[model samples]
Target: MTRTTAADVRRDITARYRARTAKSRARHAEALRYLPGGETRGATRISPYPTYMTAGEGAWLRDVDGNRYLDLLNNYTSLVHGHAPPGIVEQAADQLLRGTALGTVAPPQVSLARQIVERVPGIDMLRFTNSGTEATMMMMRAARAYSGRDIIVKIDGGYHGSHDFVEISVGAEAEAGLEPKARLESRGVPSSVLQSALVAPFNDLERMAALLEAHHERVAGIIVEPMPNTGGMIPPAPGYLAGLRELTDRYGVLLLFDEIVTLRLAPGGFQQIAGVLPDLTALGKIIGGGFPVGAFGGRREIMAQFDPAQHDQALFHSGTFNGNSITMVAGEEALRRLDAAAIARINGLGERLAAGINALFAALGIRAQCLGYGSLQQIQWTDAPVVNLGDARRAAQDTGDLHALLQAELLNRGVYSSNRGMFSVTTPLQESELDLALAALKGALQTLLPYMREVAPRLLR
Candidate 1:
């Protein structure tokens, strides 16, 4: 019998994907003419072409090609209750008839803000925004205004949405040392960003204290994700968040939590679980019920700076759709549905999924690990534990082809996930659905055996 060549496996998966997604291919080809890279967002782009999604139901998506997939990506963890739940749809529809954007401080907007302030321990008064980008951007502004400082420290590989100042050191790897340079993530971000932002590795408390000791005078706050979703879902070291709180209080600098993604880890966000509160919190994703929304809130003293009564010193914050009725009502419904019981169920499924993947890799003699916290996990190809962005990057160094193959195979088997190996569990996901996912993962890995053996032999145990 002839061995399965890498070329053979590649052609097989490509042919299968193309055959199953003819309409998707056609739509993508048309999109390429008008949209850059044939898509609106960079994250959803796949190698052959992006899938054209038509509709979504509980934990499932129907593509233009009529294929049904178990959606593990959950629109990058935004669709917490899964796409278009009955209550969210109805609430949004009622508001839609009333008004989408009333150009005033609508009741629904206030109700949503109240819901957030009540839930999050750190948030005393909060304001809404159009996106997580806006929330984080405004959070930084509030921190700076309250503290009267210009410099902000951010964790390497911690993403607080895409704006100019926070663009520093995003997913940036160190060239020669443990710390990555404060490199800007996108172009058009001003060069002055390098001075205002200082980057440090995640899960490194000693390094964080040292940074504060050196630059605490100019630093307004130190912002980080409790568990950086993009940085391989590595949990914070036991006292990492507590240590940060101590450091910030000692240095007279504010502490900020970017719970844009990690908020769903618990009912009140990761801060509640860690028993640490931030002076400011930036939120997005699940809070909006799959709509475009964002919010930031913190201590009364700091947030009071934004009050109109403060006169000249007050930070005038306003947006046309800051508290739009549609998103506000929809978001309220979303949060209401995601109670503690629902969170626990999904988190159990997520842990099971993570464990199943790790067990499968070990059984198959593959050197890989799936590390994560409640309801979230990420696959890193290297055997080493991923504690920070540098560790994650080094683990990913030689597994591009392997990852691409596995993702394609998983798609072919009716599972959809992020190309970056991040998987999120939605409230609608069931134990039975998890069984199908594990089967698909096993099938994908088995299919990729030959390719891994040939191209990434070091990955074999």
Candidate 2:
């Protein structure tokens, strides 16, 4: 085997993707009239144009052009059971017949809430919202209100939601020279909002501690994703989460675990595995059963702020579809089906996929690596360990062209990964699917090797 340089990988991948895009571009041109950018989500858009999928079943998506591909992306990891799982579909269909949304409390909501409270060790109570973005927004608001403080801390490169407060420092470029302290990422976010956030590097406990000490009084809470999914998946170093817990306690800052993406790690989530309980937790994706849902819950006292009965203390939380019957029924069914054994089985499959891909990279002599925690995995083009958002930015800057190449190649080979290499294994995916993926990866690498040898020779060396 010969090692492939990054430059060669980029050239080959671009060429392959360019050829594939010719087909996708035509569909996108047709779609632009109906949907902006030919897609609903910006994250789904890629160079050339997004491939339009007509339908999905199990772990496969059929594109509008009639191309079938293994759906490793899994609707951004929302379909834990894969597309249109019988259990979820049947339950949702039954609930839809009953009604979609009712203004009053629903039995399904209570049932799902009970299930969450039981599985998640730290959540003593819970409240529902329409999306993970809403859940995180409420969590931050509650933390600020509870502590009577202005500033909140978040891990650099961590993504909580699209809300203004937590969006700071997300996907920042390394060239921007972001400081150890937080830096805002968008305009019109309000200087006050930017000032209110403190950013620290993931896995850098010392820097986190320093920030905590410096802003002890003003810091109201610290929100972190147990394993950050954006900027590639970066798992916390051992004791890193525990250390954050201890520091938050010392500084009297609320600890919020944004498990929106990491919840699939286990039935109880990363908080259980790390043994570091937060004051609040945010959840979405799998819990919703393919429907849009989000939840924030923790200590009973802290959650009491949202009680509508309390006139003066109410948190003003209200949503037309919050705790709606349809979401609740579907969520409950999904939760019922997702027991410890099921989680273990899916995570095991994820481990297998990760290991297989890593082994393939080694065999192909590629300067690439797979990184993730539990079921969520990302393939980084560089060999460097991604510890924080800055590290991810640097990696992206170093290999953006290569990363883009690999993404196109993988898609052409019938494996649908996210633009950033994020892939999740659904319960439906088996060893056969993983094997196919590995083979596809090998073929992709082979196709790029010659280009690498001529271009970025250092990667091979």
lDDT winner among the candidates? 1
- lDDT of candidate 2 over 1-461, digit per residue (tens): 76665565565566666575566778888889999778877778766567677799998888766778898889898889888888789999998998898779988989999999999987999999999999999999999989999888888778888888976888654643456556677787777787788888778889889888888899989898988898768888999999999999898899999998888888889999899899999999889998999999998888988877753767888898998888888888887888888888888888788888788778878776788876788887667667776777776663435555666788789888888877798888888888898888788767766665565444553
lDDT of 1 by residue, 77-109 (tens): 899899889889999998888879988888988
Regions of model 1 farther than 4 Å from truth: 174-177
Where is model 2 poorest over a 10-residue stretch in terms of lDDT? 397-406
- Give the total clashing residue pairs for model 1: 0
